[model samples]
Target chain A: EPEVTQTPSHQVTQMGQEVILRCVPISNHLYFYWYRQILGQKVEFLVSFYNNEISEKSEIFDDQFSVERPDGSNFTLKIRSTKLEDSAMYFCASSRVQSENEKLFFGSGTQLSVL
Target chain B: LAKTTQPISMDSYEGQEVNITCSHNNIATNDYITWYQQFPSQGPRFIIQGYKTKVTNEVASLFIPADRKSSTLSLPRVSLSDTAVYYCLVGDPMNTGFQKLVFGTGTRLLVSP
Candidate 1:
């Protein structure tokens, strides 16, 4: 089974620095999403993308965050001037299409650690 | 937003049937009940999803009442490998868009031998 894969499984960056997390969603998936889990907190959605454009974003996706699909397979999340609270397990998910029966398949996740 | 309520933790043994219940009092008509499983340091995986009555798959079963206010995820013959956190989410997963999903503190199921 094809799975969503993320790069830099572990990322450590200094506070105020910039970081870009990357993901290659499963082939044939048309929708992509990004979410974060702050340690013990529940997984929170950040943004969703489709047709190379952002569909929806959450409050957590403020000025510092941006998502891009610069290529056919790679989806990336860029955070400018990172903050300590931004440290969390960032997940990349993809779905076949938009439907209630369509399940979002996730990648192993990239653990972002801010110093 | 539909807020779902579920247990914090549960304990089960091998060969036992495990059922975790979730209540979403404000669920909308278009929302579908879905369940996911997660191990530590990993992303959540889809288990099952249902709109009403009962829906069963090889891995698990999802039962939603007529009111659509609550749903149950049933795992049969759970074992050690079944130890993980289970999350119940209600939402509309149509192509129109994806919402910023807020997964509550999930129910931790510990299945022992």
Candidate 2:
């Protein structure tokens, strides 16, 4: 079973610093997404990417956040200025197609810790 | 996306069957009920999906009634390793261009030996 892989299983950064999280989606997948979960909170959607551009984003994804498909297989999420509240588990996911019944393959997740 | 309501937590013993139910009273015509399971410190994994009636897979079974207003996820003869949080999501995949899966507070199941 092919899966999505995320780098830097854990990251600790100071406030106001810039951080970039990288992910390699399944080779055949075309839709990629980023989601985050604060400790003891529900998972929240951040953004979705397709065709080398952002397809949609949630309110949680503000100016401080950006996503890119930097290469054929790599997808990245960059935070320009991290805040303490930015500490959470960031997950990368991908789906073979944009279908109602399609299931997403998720990475183990990158734990981002902002001090 | 239809809002889903489910139990916050459940406790079961090893080798027992566990059924987690989710209520989605406002489910739309095109909405599908999908279930995901998440262990602590990991991303959610797809368990099963169903439109109506019963859908069975290797891991679990999804039962949706004729009304389609609610669904049940049944895990047969669970073991300690089956402990995890179960999420129920309702959405119309075709209409959702971004395919964003809205997750509610999932049901945490603890299977003890």
Taken over the whole model, the C-alpha lDDT of each candidate is 0.90, 0.95
lDDT of 2 by residue, B40-101 (tens): 99999999999999999999999999999999999999999999999999999887766798
Off by over 4 Å in 2: none
TM-score of each: 0.95, 0.99
**Per-prediction interface RMSD in Å:** 1.5, 0.9
* lDDT tens readout by residue for model 2, A4-106: 9999999999999999999999999999999999999999999999999899999999999999987898999999999999999999999999876799989
Please give the lDDT score at residue B27 for candidate 1: 94
Q: Relative to the unseen true structure, what is the C-alpha lDDT of residue A28 in candidate 2, on a scale of 0 to 100? A: 94
List pairs with backbone clashes in candidate 1: A98-B95
The most accurate candidate by lDDT is: 2
Query: Which CAPRI level is candidate 2?
Result: high
